[model samples]
Target: MVRIVFVALANLLILVRYLLGLPFRLLASRHRPTHVRFRLAGDPPYRERRRAPLRLRLGGSSLEPATVSSLESFQEALGLLAKDPRVKGILLELEGLEIGSAKKDALVKLLTDFRAAGKRVVAWAVSTDSVGYQVMCAADEVLLAPAGRLELVGYAAEATALGEGLARVGIQAHFVRRGAYKTAPELFTHSHVSDIQRQTLEAFLDERYAELVEAISRGRKRSPEEVRALIDAGPYSAQRAVSAGLVDAMCSEADLPARLEPPRPEEKAKAPAESEAEAEAEESLEPMDTWLAALPWAPVKWRPVRRKPRLGLVVLSGMIVPGKGSGGPVGPTTAGADALVKAVRAAGRDKRAKALVLYINSPGGSALASELILEAVQRVARKKPVIAYVDQVCASGGYMAALGAKEIWTAPHAIIGSIGVFAGKFEASGLLERLGVRRTIIARGENAGIFSVSRGFTPHERESLEAEVEETYQAFLGHVAKARGRTKEEIHERAEGRVYSGTRAMTAGLVDRLGGFEDACRHALNLAKVPTEKFELMTYGGGARRRSLLQLLLSMSSTHLYALCPTCWGLAGFKAGEHFDG
Candidate 1:
């Protein structure tokens, strides 16, 4: 009887405790704590036992793909923290972060922003890879699990070749290229890396290695030589990384909360007669980022800066194809000539858009389409600095479009240049003949049957076609020479259809700067005489919506025969930033 009565009293006490905590939840949600906890980690949604419904996402997860709305929501949350004054410091928790270079840049920018707001940033990770360490470098302090792995090993690239296998299977790729080093067609033309491709790859690897060393050095405040030595002996354990000065300390996750800043004194005294429970609830409320969101005003003093309208950011991603529709699944997401031209001209005419940035990620397509867009870009450059940012795959016709920009800035691994031309059609004469099928051609002109797949090119016809392609090649060279401030002869030396990595390309005089989109923006703003604070980035090429699959397929009917690099067309199988590591 005594035990039962005691249990009843305990249940009543539990109910009273829960009821008393109800008001503290609101205080926790609305008030900004002195030390903000930056939950910078995200788990794959699939890992959860009872999967969360889509609506359960407060805004969206960074683990998901970067859609427009998700990106905006992330920026909004970040802005709230940047503008919050009660946030004196931050404790970053990085469980796992998978991101590409562009996203990494954005995260680094966020860290910089929070720091600029006078918040001290600290980070803790269970494990670290090259990417993690890169981001952690932005933090004022970095702590890692004692047993965690620190993967600081350098970069590597590998290429695949399938030419000889195709030939043995009775398929032949009879193609012509203007550049001797254009590696796009090499996979199907040669079983191994050709001498020129090897040369290109070696130079590229050197560039990437150097970039990694420099980045690590800058982050750790170590000399370049020291960083190189450390990276050469990398993939360190957390303890070793700490001993090597790569990390601040080896710490367990539980210790993170204890190390945060002590509460700062309030500017104003609280009202008299406050209950002890209320005071305890307020003090124990912990958050890494400011909870300034949804509040009418900040908890501390802050100024609201209006969004600037200055720089025009025009994205010209995907393949360079003709017509107004995007490409199909079997094809590529095309940058339509009509759409690109419109975007460029619009940026040029917009009075507020003082500078322009052409962010290109394309494996070149239609030569004619590239030329059309190039003309529009050149006009934009005439009015303002058109900084072309080569994201990854910028080759052949893509290079042509980049030439129009006042200066070209390539990402560390950007593939640029292919100042060459290639165009041909496949013939199935042998297969048809072996099957005892014959094709009869009804033609009037001398070149009427030139495009017929039933037969291969005749001797005279082949010679004539070669001459035509040669003329196109010369035209390409002339345009490049004029745009790059080089003579035709000088351009020819580097013209033999060789694609260059950004670092190697700079040495080859193909790109002006080896940096990313941020660098491009800064250069554009500088050239246009615009201050960074006064100007804002306004997107230009987002005027059109993505077309349906049916629309893309139907639009192909409007395309006509034109000069384009077939090697580049096949490279659609290769992702952006993939290079022949040869």
Candidate 2:
């Protein structure tokens, strides 16, 4: 009886709010803007942008009066412009855009589609790096501020080693890794790069450089050789870029409106009455936020309903770890095993979901967590087809989780493979001794003190730890072999913690196809035998919700036997924990 009354009161409040806002909503709808301007700046949550408002939103509160400018919102605004007859074109203000190469490619393709629909896209940027410039290149006309610069320097990878620095502070790192190319431990155990590590880094840089050259070549209508030469000669000033045909022209932000709307050939002799309205409409572009705010009824807009089959998209990003992961927009992100397992199981039980796409963007982490996620993925695969889509860096345990999927798709330049394991801890006995701090130990088992930072591992303990890591390594190889329908020996040939680019991984049988997220979704639908027209893609467990500082600290404190790729993590601009103050 109480619950019923609460529900009734909630509905009453919603009705009252709707009634009060109806008049304003109607007025705003009548005065809808003629053109939309989208600002593509900063890194947001979503990977792709839509051109218009969604006919249907998949999740989240409908009544919450809040708006966050994300990739999806930008896409929706562009989509609206594409469909609205009144909307003549879109202005893409691309400034300081920080996104991965795969996302850049996706955005470029989106612009291409928009242009194909007879809409013009004018991109304006102040200052941007090579990655941002690549996305800007997709627009019909690229504009830059007079003083802005393009940092088009070629790609380079840097790795930091702390062995010598740790030794100076009377500390040492004792670690064991299974593969020669597994250079993650070197950051602690070696002072400099190993032959294998140097080789691996060089190979990665070469692949990424080649990808950048190709993208710029296609965008600028230049040969690959020419693109490489131009990049080598960069960073370019705005005027220099225009002179070299890298950018179309130099224009200030205030002058963009005049540039966008030159005297139209057919409108030169328009009636005086028409010119006034046209001039007013073209005076300023309306932001998507203002347009959305005007239409409070937009959320409840009516649409035809259909009982279509759904594709479940589960995104596993950041460092894969045990337990519910921590952090969000305020700190480092983690992919918790418990959250992912529950999400995958939920998708498996959902009757409407006919297929699943496990979108992976991680460098891997805890071995146990990876195993748990892979187990859940395999369970879902039995009931519905599951495909893995590698977005950027999927290595070590990240690849381990991917093995559970029936097939894997990867971006051409995505970092894949790294089939290996490593485990160890910092030994601070010397540091303690140097500081004249004495400690006593008490233990109940032979290996009870194996993980104690106060002392190094005993010979017996070291032997035991190595055996355990070796067993895990063998199991990893076995899983990969079983998933690919190959023998352990054949898989072992490529299982030395060595990473591969997406194209090379396909040739190595590590992944089934070279494609992006959309391709993976389509393949999932095809495998499930669901019609594309009658299918809807539903996402699961990709939230980056903030956690308390205490929770974040706790999450980072716990240690595990890792299947992580430190090299990849470092290259991605993450810093691993180190002893002593910086």
Candidate 3:
């Protein structure tokens, strides 16, 4: 009882800590009016807007307690700047903008728009690596902290095969794939990649690498040879990057504001030491916000939320399955056909939905489920514009679903395109014989027991399964060729069940645009022809909601959820362990 009491108290303390630290607005805003104001103050989107020519800090990650930054929040922030009339130029302050290439692509598009309006977009990095450097390259003037370093190593991918581990476990993975280059099974069946797999991987890498080089060349305003040379001698100090023409200037982050602004008639550049000391003195006087001051212990209000409509976002972010979908919040997610199709059809039917963006992040599963999802998405496309955004690892069935979209947008480093199908059965007769266990099965149908683990497939059964796999593969090829407006030869040349990087996939005609979430959102919005930018985005419940301990405790009693899985219960009762071969 005493131990339990202590545990409860600890939980209470943790809940208190989190609630106190929440980002809810605690203080009332000052009611005042100022003339000739640019509303680009460093404030959250929820805060009331003011003047124009916004200044937003982009390099830092989202506020803590939020582990990763959501692309939605970033988009909304950038979208506000893109739409607001008071905002002309945006000064993007970069601290450590560690985001994937998909998010980066979105930033590039937003930044490009900012420039197209004749507004200056300046990027200044305090500390950065290649990912941060990429964003800086998009800015009109790339500024780096004096002590910071910039690393620009090219792309790389590595995979491991676990055939030996399975062999040691006395498990046989018998797989039959249609394509010669279908290498998914090889990860479990081969100790090393096959020669054909190596060739395909090399081709993927070459295409992506060339694209990377070209992007860097264009961003840095350097020749391909110059960018390639820089990549070879990567990880340069700020001074080295400036000397190599990879970045525009090298200055301490403290002096960045003046750098962002033009020199007044009497203004002159000062030394780093004078600037740093002055910056420190000025920063010390800045008052701490009331929320941060009381963060150690404070009460928070959970207010009701208001919803408005903008674009429809349907996310399919897990393995495809063929029943009631098992995903969202906590998950070993299974993207079910029934649930996914419903989401698609709902988006299509919604009159308020100006456009639909299908965000895919799956490696693919269940051919039947994938096909159903594809058909549903095609229906939505017929009504309104649909854009597919492959965040990462869209392969096989995932790729099939993506093709249903009018245009495919992917991050440069995002993985896409795996056109192959296979079937497999585990044979455990050897293990059974070693364990001195006798099992027998009797079936009337010819192929009823084809999947029985007590025996391997007969030659006739093997031929039949192979033929079925081949038919699926051919169907995949035909659909891809037709949708992409490419010949079978052209599609098959890149198929071979191989995954390609986003840029490489675009080159192979497997994907349309090399961009990120922002790009896809904008594309769908543009296709819908949204007259004004003051629109709200609504996201479907295809993701997990991070709940605070307090919220969980408060809702725990009200929440009623239970799973009645009879097969799992029976298996557990039998003490099957890893020895359940049937």
Name the candidate that leads on TM-score. 2
lDDT of 3 by residue, 194-253 (tens): 786566556655754575677678788889888788888876888988898887888774
Q: Specify the poorest-scoring 10-residue window by lDDT in model 3.
A: 31-40
Winner on TM-score between 2 and 3 is 2
Clashes (N, CA, C under 3 Å) per candidate = 6, 9, 9
Model 2 per-residue lDDT tens digits across residues 210-313: 76788788878999989988988888999999998999999987677768767587777999889878876667666776666566465543222344578887
Q: Tell me, by lDDT, which candidate is best.
A: 2
| Candidate 3: residue 176 lDDT (0-100) | 79
Worst 10 residues of 1 by lDDT: 44-53
RMSD after CA superposition, every candidate: 12.6, 6.7, 14.1
lDDT of 1 by residue, 276-362 (tens): 444455543254232543233334321123335477777776667776645344434667888888878888888888888887767
User: In lDDT terms, how accurate is model 3?
Assistant: 0.62
Query: Which residue runs does candidate 2 get wrong by more than 4 Å?
Result: 1-36, 44-88, 116-119, 264-281, 287-302, 442-444, 542-559, 570-582
What's model 1's overall lDDT? 0.65
lDDT per prediction?
A: 0.65, 0.77, 0.62
Query: Each prediction's TM-score against the native?
Result: 0.69, 0.81, 0.63
